[model samples]
Target: MELINQTRASLIDYVCAQIATFFPDGADTKAAITRNFAEAMGRVEKCFGAIRPWPAGKFNYLQSAQYCLFLYYLANTIWRNDDDSGTATRLFLLNKTLNGIDLFYEIQMPDIFVLGHSSGIVLAKATYGNYLVLHQHCTVGRNYEVAPVLGEGVVMYPGSSVIGRCRVGDHSVISIGTQVVNRDTPGNCTIYQGDGGELAVRPAGRNLIEEIFRV
Candidate 1:
């Protein structure tokens, strides 16, 4: 993949600088970053290449959404491969500080996903699937320690939420501003808040995931 305005060494330095600036604790990040940087970028490439909105095989560090995903992959790579919790924590904090997104590094995200806007988005530790797309002010969180399980090709629009023991089926579209709490949806459905604030479901009519991803 083409890394716009970043070579491997430059990107590593950039991340280390961000961590140091945000944390200012004098912790060593170079070793952990060096150990896991390539794997992390590989994951980023795979994800970015799959998304249709993003130009395939190219990564732009100036883009907030792409940078957010990069930070997540970097943190996750270090955590999983090097068992470097301190560095991983710093990366997570840096991402939150810069992007206003609360995506913990430990959360097991799928290999291919898209974030329309990272601001005001919170993704909890839950079962996720490939080709998931999340927009601004969207949330997939837990209720009383119970999180929602999302299937393949799920799309959560802006201001939409799926909280607490919800089973969102494959190709399901959670409409804008809809709140799905403690409910289940069938595959290929669109979830919305009906009249009187009740949950409603209807066929999505089109495959949004197919359009967004190179599936």
Candidate 2:
């Protein structure tokens, strides 16, 4: 999706302000922090182009919260180096308390992914695809040492999980309340819990990311 350029600078400045809050006494760190913030904002702008106005307007409260949470994590994980552990921890805890986004547990962001909501979501250090949308109450975790590998354009609806060493194909949707463990899902399909709690798959209705955002 093409981003609206008018709000980009404001958004970057806001993110830099947030990073500054964690290092009030570190004037020496300002230059490095600002540089990292710029890099993080680039990734955030690419991933969350759908949410306008940076923190978003009043009517888009959920989107605003989600964007903030994403920024917090991205700033620490994707941009800042390991030398900034103290500041990164502070930002991580703040995000967890404010947005209930538990990304501290080995979660890493994809180059471009969207969060539908910021509550009850758990992500591990798995291979996430671009244009992924994660709704509320979703989990993408590992089983022992094995992690799930998701293809591009995947969507996980509320209460859905893709666990273990499963491979989910591109354009696949994990329907609400579905749990996929140690299985492989094909591309352009939807998976749901069927009778007796069995996981089922069918052709996906449409390309949501393409249809909605034309990304």
Best by TM-score: 1
Tell me the alpha-carbon RMSD of every candidate: 0.9, 4.8
Candidate 1 lDDT, tens digit per residue, 1-215?
A: 78898898998999999888889999999999998988998999999999998898999999999999999999999999988999999999999999999999999999999998899999999899999999999999899999999999999999999999999999999999999999899979898899987988888878888889999
Tens digit of per-residue lDDT, candidate 2, span 66-138: 4555556454653345456554555566566566666762356666666677688878888988778888889
Candidate 2: residue pairs that collide: none
What is the Å distance of residue 155 in model 1 from its true position? 0.4
- Those runs of model 1 whose alpha carbons end farther than 4 Å from true positions after fitting are none
The best candidate in terms of lDDT: 1
Please identify model 2 stretches exceeding 4 Å from their true place.
1-32, 50-66, 77-82
What are the lDDT figures for the candidates, one per model? 0.93, 0.68
